[model samples]
Target: MVRITDEQIEQWRRDGYVLIPNFLSKEETEAARNGVFEWFSPSWDDYVAAGRKIDKPGVLAFPWDNSGLNKAVLHDDLIDVAERILGTKDIHLRLVRLDEAHLGIKYAGNPSNNSLPDVFHQDWGNNTIGPHHPEDFCSPAFFYCLDDVKPGMAPVQMVKNGLEPNPKNAEKFICPGGSLCIYSTWTWHASSEFEAKEGHRPTMWLGFNRNDRMWEGGRFFTIKATGTRDGWLRAIGEATPRQRELLFLPAVDDEKWTDEMIDGMFKRYGKHGFDPEPYRQAKAKREAQTNGKH
Candidate 1:
């Protein structure tokens, strides 16, 4: 696990973003790449070995059945850094995805090498559900490179000050595999056209915001979290407490954790291995302390 230094935190404050190289180990990166292939295309290894050219982009939204990607996204170190940037432990998980750069496509849906103006924009529009102003929302996000993103591999470019939306003034995020770039919804960033002749450029993106802000929400097109998706249930069942908390599950010590609620939750999610003992113990402790005090 990598620790975010004071210098990195200061850098984030000054530039609205920070890049940490080698944040994830080589082993971790390989696991993530394998996980992406497992979920996105099980035959990806064979395709790559055969030098097959892909015509379409590869994308998978959050709550998918990819444990490798899930571990990296919900990583303890990643969450700590997010809390530090967002200034709260009570954070909502906004987005998690596998965004790959394909051979003939660009970020904005134009064919690669097409004569089109570079598109640079802030994420606040989609993140905040079209807030009245960009300033009204702030969702800190992480872009983790699962592959070495060199020039022409669809590297993302962002304005240094997070203010300018010009292509000429943006800095490209060219980093090695296992690297991470932390940016916010306020940052102006754009993905470049994929120019690499072959191979894959896999990246994972995760975003979060303060849980208290109801107005600040997720991207509109992502699958609803409350749906009967198998991924949703798997995540809820298998996730750790810290991970579950980001999914809007109240902490064990939260005031809302009553005996009745605990029992209800056990009934609802018990089939998926949802353990209620933590909540049960917490409630018992709270009641015991209250009785003793009275």
Candidate 2:
């Protein structure tokens, strides 16, 4: 029973983004942070030590390999906001990225020797899938902070209301460890420099898209770059039915929906005080419509 306020919805509609502070408990944030450190830090450190380009493109795929990290991505509050904002229960996880900014890593061949590549741009491009219009809210990126992100800690600078080239109005996402900063994929944003002398800025990037979309740019890149299809399938296999629904795989046909499935749904969602009857009824209607069309 998580809810999004009308004011929050209006803010997103107006600014193309919203920051929900304290969206996760401190315990939840700590668990996710530990999981990332355990699972991703080694490779990330190796990449840095190799003197490879710091601004290497592509994300760390399938961090859900860690069960704790998987749970964070499927956190109820995050899902509720996503579903409400996207205006759909049928959502798909386009990407799960673990991004870290260390104290002294900088882009290669840059004279400034800045510790971050502060490039302001949108996630979508000419080669991206679907319409390029800014009005299309098909994809959204949720950034879950794993550390208290203060200014100069490489907080992401976003142009409020999609306004770019206006430094006076740019909004820096400085918040506590458990905050969730959500923005449309089309919104203009960039990372600030890691001005802190020590420590790391770790954040989990969860990108999602409406299920009806035929193509997802991140999904395409993930499968290609990370060879993660098998791992992803395994992760999904381990998820609960509700979690599987978030993955946006083809739904189980209503004809195949058994008493056991319905009971399981109740057993799971009921604990959260959710009544599943309405969802079940609506699903049945959708099935009826599909069967009729067939």
Top-scoring candidate (lDDT): 1
Residue 213's C-alpha lDDT in candidate 1? Answer: 72
Best by TM-score: 1
Q: How accurate is candidate 1 locally (lDDT)?
A: 0.66
TM-score of each: 0.79, 0.69
Per-residue lDDT tens digits for candidate 1, residues 127-215, read 56544554432567778888787787677787867456777887887899899888777777777766666545667777777877755
Give the Cα lDDT of each candidate: 0.66, 0.61
For model 1, what is the error of residue 120's alpha carbon versus the real structure, in angstroms, after optimal superposition?
A: 1.5
Report how far residue 260 has shifted in candidate 2, in Å: 14
Question: Per-residue CA lDDT of candidate 2, range 1-294, in tens?
Answer: 564576986787788788888777888888876666655542235445756434332325553345556677777777777777779978866653222111122222232343233567676762255667878776677777777777666677778764653445568888998788778778777777666654456677666666777465454333345424543544554555566566553355444455566667556545534345645775788778989998
TM-score of 1: 0.79
